[model samples]
Target: MDKNELIQKYFEKSLSPEEAAMFENLLADKEFADEVAFQKKIKKVITHEERATLKDKLRTFENQKTSTDKWWYAAASVFVLLGTAIWFMGQKPDYDTLYASYYETYPNVIAPVVRNNNDTITDTEKAFAYYEKQDYNKALEIFQTIIRTSPQEEYAQFYSAISYMELAKFSEASKILSGTNWSKKYADDAIWYLALLELKTDNPDASRKFLLEASKTSRYQKESLELLKKLD
Candidate 1:
């Protein structure tokens, strides 16, 4: 397939292993490098914009909470009384309810491509597959194991941060991504994610700062530019 077809298939996650290998090899070719760069930029901007819009809507809901009707408060009070009664009667708060609540609060992050040399590729691939399928808990288990086994693996670190982000664990994601020991490839990605996390948390200033730093590097220049434009 041609370069554009290869890129389209890659974005669709439909490329065969051989096709993927060929695409990776083409990253070295200067002529088609611009196309790859553009794709990454577009992906970042689209994801960031979608998430930012959600954040704005969430903020609006939070701001308008005080204006909710009396019936809403009455319903909440009834629920709370029922919950307290259940607690007093020694019945556990339902595990399924808790799990569902947690899932609602924290969505899963997109999984990263795992490297074969630093850890067990099969396990990493399994975790990534689970993440892709939106089975966040299983993916988190594998990511935690990878970090425990190889704390210095930047690929694992990056993905771990993403997992936290997906779960809306912004503070945890920020903490992991803020570290200085990441590989160049992972570091670039981390910076971009960090900027998005800041934006999600309503700290546009910090987001802009992180984006500015990311814009200096060729790897993230296009995305950073697009994000900066949005902030303006």
Candidate 2:
């Protein structure tokens, strides 16, 4: 059998045992070996079904009168393979799974609702009530009011950011989380949540930075270090 015929049959996966032996012998020639290497490169970019079509077209091209046509086809195949490799390399990390694995809304720690107490409930308690019920919009409304009245209310600021995050208002959440002076109560907690917010927004680098800082804190150090390893 002709060398080109054997190579085509090999690629098409239709080679008999005898033809495979002939194909192996052809690989001893330097030019034939290089051609096989070129075919291997194209193989990496195509599916198994497409490989059959590729081999057929290569065989047909070689049968034509001009050697230049075969050279051009190989060149085009390399171009396409390189383009495919670049595209796969540029694909972003999977954010959805990462976010889902790590995300949980912050709990209502600042205010505990007493169902039948004689004392009047404050605005902070009302907001935390809404937060525990997962009514983030209403909770945020009351939190904003508290922050306006008392700028140093750390609990209001932290939960406001948490409410924004629950509403998928990443920009607002990031603004509050980034600007707030996290008290000892919420220092590592705030930093850890900020890392998660960045991960949700597909900002892995920013998430990694926050995780690194969180790793230095007491509360979230172990979790932050583990998440940092996953990012790397």
Candidate 3:
């Protein structure tokens, strides 16, 4: 069978044992092998496109605090300045009122940092310490606990995923990270690992999808974007 037919049959799991053997033999041909690789890439792009909407939602929620804080300052300053200018131009003094209004609507912006009350040192710190000591199993245990107890804890999940990847269990790492519903903090990082797993597993399509999703977040945005560019 041709490369197209072989690939289709492979995906469908409909290839007979003889056909499968023949397909494997065809992989020895450089042109046929390249075609298989190209199909994998296409699959990645398609998967990534499917998750685009979810990725956008995650980004929106994750950046809400930063975006809100930035705009709050800008709007408040503009309102206060405009009010002062108006007062100075012989209009009624409204600077105080405008400032009050702005203050009431927009409190101070404080970025939320993830804190783990369950541990002495932070989970990330502990995980790294264990990792540096070459106690990967211990590090993996701590990271896994953090993930199970506090899935939203970005650094812990990131470290855990890294540990799994380091152990060469890409599928396990990907399974732990795929469709994760945590805040934007570790989501992108997880996506990055998932992409790497897909690449390692020879699933270019899945890798492309993950890279695309990761590109939407600020954490891995630059790297993901660059990867996508290179792929193109």
Best by TM-score: 2
Write down the TM-score of every candidate: 0.47, 0.58, 0.42
> Model 2 RMSD to the real structure?
19.9
| Per-candidate clashes, comma-separated | 2, 0, 3
**Worst ten-residue run, lDDT, model 2?**
41-50
- Give the whole-model CA lDDT for all candidates, comma-separated: 0.68, 0.78, 0.62
Off-target runs (Cα >4 Å) in candidate 1 are 1-121
For model 3, how does the per-residue alpha-carbon lDDT over 1-232 read when each residue is reduced to its tens digit? Answer: 5556677677668999999999899989997887677657655775586457445645554566476575665556557656864566565333233322222111111112443555566766666667767677798898788778887666566566666766766676776677556565455556676766666676655665677667667766666655544433
| Model 3, C-alpha of 219: deviation from truth (Å) | 4.3
TM-score of model 3 (CA atoms): 0.42
Best model number under lDDT: 2
Model 1 per-residue lDDT tens digits across residues 1-232: 7676687677779999999999989989986777677657766876787668655655655566675554575456557656864575575333233223322222324335334566555767887887778776688788889889977655666777777877778898899889657776567777777777777777766776677678878977876776665554
- Sorted by lDDT, highest first, which candidate order results? 2, 1, 3
Report RMSD for candidate 3: 21.1
Off by over 4 Å in 3: 1-125, 147-154
lDDT, residue 182, candidate 3? 58
